[model samples]
Target: MPLILFNKPFQVLCQFSPQEGRESLADYLAIPNIYPAGRLDADSEGLMLLTDDGKLQHKIAHPDHKEAKTYLVQVDGVVDAAALARLQAPLDLGDFVTKPCKAVQIAEPAWLWPRNPPIRARADKPTSWIAITLEEGKNRQVRRMTAAVGLPTLRLMRSSIGAFSLATHPLMPGEFVEVEAEALRVGG
Candidate 1:
């Protein structure tokens, strides 16, 4: 079985198949039979895992597995302690209540690459970076949670999922590296 770690770029679809004019993993990945373990929205960027093993994919993607996914978020405001607290608490996103997770303000990571086309800038408002870890992967959950707490997410990047991290296996945007399948299995 093949396990690949890819650094997904902004505006790139998560799947390996073609998607009209928009860019997809096919543009960068040509490894047949491997599919993305989890998805990142077109607007989001960073580490993504791909695999041919179904069980490993399930272990990585399933919410019941409770594998923590860490995101480095840049929001459009100075996030105070109160705001961080709100982010750490169980947030009600109307459709579902988010499970309590780790949220902390972090200095910008040096490894980060500037996004192409760039995030919108506000001459008056400032931006802050925060690291948030969530076990449940809801659709656009991080963005919604930050917005609910009065901070709008400007950029979101999944830096790690469980023990697999972008730091440990570095890949620039649109680049990928293959890893052993056993290395990714939970507690393997």
Candidate 2:
């Protein structure tokens, strides 16, 4: 069984199969047997782990394991400390209250690659970046959380999962790398 790390690109589906003429995991990864440990939405991009080992997948995806998933989010408007603080607290989302999470502004640099189609820019409004981490994997949780805090997410990317961080292995949109099971098993 192999443990793999992928730097998922924006608009790419997490599954190996195709979707409605759009890109899928098949296009980026050729390895067999390994499946995504968890998932990143089609609209989001960044670090995703894959494994042929079912137990590893369960450990990573099961909410009870409480694996922290980190994301780099670009949102509409200039987010302030109050909004960041709100994100750090429990969020009432009507259906359920989100668990406490970390949120902080990130420094911007010109080196950040541009999205293929690019995020929409509002002439009258500004945008900001935020780094968020969550233990639970709810559908579109980061985007929803930002919206709940009066900040709409313009772009979202998962930067790291557990001990694997995109910082150490920066990947272009669809690139992936194989990892030793021993490496991933350490932090979990």
Candidate 3:
């Protein structure tokens, strides 16, 4: 089965079709027949898995499988111990409560690429980096959770899904590497 690990860039749509005035996967990926197992918002950047194998795709993307997705997030304000505690706790997001996940303050990753339109910087306000790992994929969940705790996410990038990490694979934005489907295990 054809399995691909793609480093999706900011402002690039997750779909493989063309979109007027916006970058889509078609701009970078020419490989046919493979579809994204999951989605990353156009504003978020990082590792995405694509595959032609339906079974493998379901295993990777389905929330029931509980594959942990790790992100390197840059929030607009300083994240103190209290904020970090809130982040690690199960958060009530109105529609649903987020599952308890790992959250820790981390130094900015030196390997991260700069976004084309840089995130807005406030001269007076400070920014901080944090690592968040979640087993469930929700729509703009990370952004919303941070905002609820008074730390708005400025830049969000998913660094890994399950055991497959962008750091280990080392693909630049819009670049991809193909691997055998069996090489990856769900929830690993």
What TM-score would every model get versus the actual structure?
0.95, 0.93, 0.96
Better of 2 and 3 by TM-score: 3
- Decide which is better by lDDT, 1 or 3: 3
Q: Report the alpha-carbon TM-score of model 2 versus the true structure.
A: 0.93
State how far residue 88 of model 2 sits from its true place (Å): 0.3
Estimate, for each residue in 15-100, the C-alpha lDDT of model 3 and write its tens digit. Answer: 97887999999898888788899999999999999988778888989998888999899998888999989989999999999999
Candidate 1: tens digits of C-alpha lDDT, residues 44-111 = 99989888887788888887778789999999999999999998999899999999999999998998
Q: For each of the candidates, give the backbone clash count.
A: 0, 0, 0
By summed lDDT, the worst window of 10 consecutive residues in model 1 runs over: 179-188
Order of quality (lDDT): 3, 1, 2
Off by over 4 Å in 2: 109-111, 185-188
- Candidate 1, TM-score vs. the true structure? 0.95
Looking at model 1, the pairs that clash are none
lDDT of each: 0.89, 0.86, 0.90
Identify the candidate with maximal lDDT.
3
User: Per the 3 Å backbone cut-off, how many clashing residue pairs does candidate 1 have?
Assistant: 0
Instruction: Give one digit per residue, the lDDT tens place, for model 2 in 1-188.
Output: 65788988888888987778889999988988888988989899889999988888888888887778888999988999999999999999888899999998997534467888898877999899999999897988999999999999998989888778788877777888887767553335
**Residue pairs in collision within model 3:** none
